[model samples]
Target: MTLFRESFATQQSLPPWEARGVQSWCFLFPLSATAIQRYLDEYFNFAHPEPAPFRFSALAEAQFGCLTISYYPVIASTNKANMLRYGPQTTSWDHLSYNEMYVAAPVLCNRVTPDNLLVDRQIVWIQPVVMCDNSSVVFATREIVGIDTMHATINLRPGRAPGSLHVDTQFSGFKTFSPTTAEGPLPFLHLETGSPLPGGLPEAATREDKAFLEGLFGVIGGVDLVGGVRPTTTRLISLKQFRDAYDLRLATYQAIVASTATHTDVSDLRFFDPKEVDLDFMWSASAEQILSSFLQLGRPGDEKASAPHEGPGWDLVGRQVKIKVAFAYTNNAVYDQIETLHTFGAE
Candidate 1:
């Protein structure tokens, strides 16, 4: 076995992070494919063989409406030995739990094998924005794994109806586009889901629902018909890089990392009708500038002009875009691990 060096400060003791009883809510919506591609190409530093070992793209121009917003009620490292390794200080800090939310789009990562012979292709989620309430999680996920994670205030509470949830996340950003505005916690995204409809899958499927399910299963993979269940082992890809301390323009280290999270026990697998979903996004100059693609706000000078609304952003109601899928599940004994798929800079 190859032993690795320990991390510094808060995350030093916990090498491999694990969680228990992780409950998650997932909502899927349609997004412009061209916009997704443009975002990946410009921000993620993706290119053909030039970025070297790997190339990535959306699953299909038309079939890929795989924009997803996932919320985790709490994420904490539950390993007893890792917690108490260095005694009280390590135990106290390592056990902190936090709420997290991230927006991602499914894409295909086509990579050249280690032998430099054939190409290996796989489906992975390219996460553009990941926010959590805990600083430790922010540092570890960003510095250690290259997950471009940021700190945010995440609130999860029971909705007005039974067995429903409302989640809202805020991050520091310019409330309005002006020199007078100061950066502070502003609205980022909001989600309100009705009670989980009592069913496995909707029997009377609309064209929109069918398209949504097909796009979902494309990324989810593996369905057990006999058992009437769909199990998922999600693999996420991230471009981890560090800029030179002296010259910010130069990258000291850069690599493409692939991470895995598996649901060992999944329960309460239920769906939500389109009518039951209410999702909203507010324009925070800090977060939304990069997220406009996922939100389907067309580029500048486009005929679809921006309609002014209260505050800094325009209101995006769920029904206007026709939300495809809404569901929630509980998973116990979830595991997370990462591996470097390709390194482009520094030994």
Candidate 2:
């Protein structure tokens, strides 16, 4: 929300920091890397508390401008993935990581601002992820996130498409929590000022972005969005992908609760799901494409909106797109999770 630029943008980057603030607005202290390691390993693995408190050292708060709202420590990766849904089969996938924070707040920057304009007044921070056709990953040291004490499953009835003959879905889901264990700190990426994106933030807002920021407000207030951290993005899974993955995550969660509760089948049970497969996709883009292809008028997929000067598929593809749509989910209970964490119908 705030725009910041500074005199010393060129000398802004801190030596070591990665704690990212989502709409949460979290920032890190200038601790030694050794101390930071201890914090991450020993003391930082939980959600934030009510009022969505700001986490910052006095110096950090002064430097970054806004008090951070919330942060993701050790963010493995933050980017968007989108799958085009078309064709008779309606066979496609889309997952946008509303999980990554938009670094709208101020901090260090690599470049100095124009003297007359402002230094560190504001710098957009962008994650220049590889093209949608490509992606990369970061593997951090794996650690066990804590388990909850109670969980409840809700059954969802199916529905039919309006004026049509397509089956919707039927499935089950649950949310568990350990209310006793309060939240802890997180370390995120402190991208400098003057990066890119409007007002020097990272990615632009999409549907998932709206869901995440709104849900985050509730979570920080101690309501437990889904008995856990709400998912950071939204998803569009095929009906089959929904049924199949929901079954898997539920099964995995069931086994986890069973073992944590009684430890009776700890040996017999195991977690099984493919990693490295696509589960989520966001709709973000690089600076060039965002400008070049974005339609100044009309809907994205509308052929009539395509100008003759533009080439093939130009109107149908690119950023800032919206359309009238209808979607179905197994039910509303874990619908957000289906959008965020469920991993069926992966690419």
Candidate 3:
């Protein structure tokens, strides 16, 4: 069993008040410490490099990004009004929720001008992609968008990689089998799970109270610092494989909502797609990056993607490329565990 109380609840960001706006905030999963560590050592290390700046690492901290950052208020009588600018307004666990795993950075700001000019004193946080049983099965791949909450029209982060920009991402998907289990099926891509998130899945999750299980792990936790998430893609799943996974997920979701009152239709169906075949696009995150490269694995117009074999598939591309898996984080050493029976879901 895993401990899911306060120990898993609240954790402080290390080296607080980073001027560059980069702080290593904790991701408290309900999983066990050992399981997390093993995944980090055996699985993740195999896929990415250790502290590799460009591939998987924490968001690179810039020089003097913030004029000042503070976790506590200091008494500055002469500059009393600006005290809030130097300190964190709230360090309590209110940013957390029982419905989903917490994924947020320590970001706060203060005014610089008298009209209370808010310069970079703004912050943006992309809420975690919580799992939900009520989630409708979306055909789209999983995506993590970081919006500029501070500025009305300015929150997209671009990268040197292909496709779009400003997508500060960390991979977080669930495994089908328990790491503690002797050995079972390889874990499938399972990102959402729980009683139901606050608003429920992303299209997000939630509820008044009750507990559920969920796993939140990222593939490229630090792809931001270098080459912009070289998004080392690897999973080579087929259409049939994806459909099977989708079926199981749909069934699980229906069952959850069935127990609730009049769910009518799938108005509350979870929307994100967390399957192997869905993402893996080269342009995508690891999941997306995988597909883009894998597509090159076969010739063009090949209806289905198959490794090199005498099959009626893409006539242009040739060969079978296998994708590998190992969870990687931007920051190398800091790892944690979540202990729980909660399935990847929402409240």
Candidate 4:
């Protein structure tokens, strides 16, 4: 019958990933695909329009503002000199890596109906283009290339049409009837085999068969067999009808305000804010410890950090600490942006 029923019947066991995929497909299958596709096309088209400055008052006024930043994590170098001198505690002395970043554009869909459903539905389809080094000189060059990830946030307000009401009623009753056959009064009489009694026909046949025929055509209580006419001794039917009408009106109004939304972002594109908006005693203490460590044993420069020192007792730690902190702050800002877009509306 339905795809859901067919899937349920045919599919036996499913892996977690497969199961989730199936469920997602099932959920989206009923929706208009053309509508969704068009929505996506418009969403990206609107987002990628000539980069112009945009501002949201609510976000700008907030403590975090619209600013987001991120830092790429430092990868330990395989160089022997680096391992001997800094090892795990090298800080800025370690090789630096950077994460990719992007600014987010907000898209709003208002007063959306079934006809307007596609307008907000397309964000789910937008995907990020994947990138990787392919040069022969690089050791880790070849990698899968396609859409790597995306970040999306959606707010929905679902609504329904006006003045629509639905109602249903059920009736169950039993009636008595007689038969003319010699085997008379059986629940199911064989119409062809049953013989008619003498004197034109039996009384049972006359009365019971007549009643059965009349009932079959819906003629009860001497009213027209097809037309409905109920005998009433009260004057409340009009009020009941009014109540049903009001309920329908209320339901339609309520339906207009319902909605669904989703937010998602890819990991590679994740970014965070580097600056600390609020600083407490703990953060100050941590900063002091870091600065103290840097001043006590910091490298003079990147060259010294990368190269071997000749002095009998020379320590190059300060320069490496500064480099590490810079990288850390950058990555932190990038990660903050990612988190903001991910949980942007949560706060």
Candidate 4: worst-modelled 10 consecutive residues by lDDT:
20-29
TM match of model 2 to true structure: 0.16
The candidate scoring highest on TM-score is 1
Span of ten consecutive residues with least summed lDDT in model 1: 300-309
Model 1 CA lDDT for position 306: 27
TM-score of each: 0.80, 0.16, 0.16, 0.16
Off by over 4 Å in 3: 1-116, 120-123, 128-130, 134-303, 306-347
Residues 299-347 of candidate 1 have per-residue lDDT tens digits of 3332342232344433322112456666666665444677887777444
lDDT of 1: 0.64
Tens-place lDDT digits, model 4, residues 204-269: 234634443343223113432122111111010000001136556421111001111111221111
Clashes of each: 0, 43, 81, 45
Residue pairs with backbone atoms closer than 3 Å in model 1 (clashes): none
Quote the lDDT for 293 in model 1. 59
C-alpha lDDT values of all predictions: 0.64, 0.20, 0.20, 0.19
Give the poorly placed runs of model 2, Cα more than 4 Å off.
1-216, 222-301, 304-347
Cα deviation in Å at residue 79, candidate 3?
A: 38
Question: Worst ten-residue run, lDDT, model 2?
Answer: 254-263
lDDT of 3 by residue, 113-183 (tens): 44535454332111212221111111111110111011001112222333212211122322223465342
In the range 1-347, model 2's lDDT, one tens digit per residue, is: 56333233222221111222212212211112232222222212112221111111112222111111121222221111111112223422222221222111121222223443324322111111111111111111000111111111111122132221111111111111245533221111111111111221123246754444343333223533233222222221111111136555432221100001000111111111111111111111212231222212222344243221233222222222221111111111111111111222223
Candidate 3 vs candidate 4: which has greater TM-score? 3
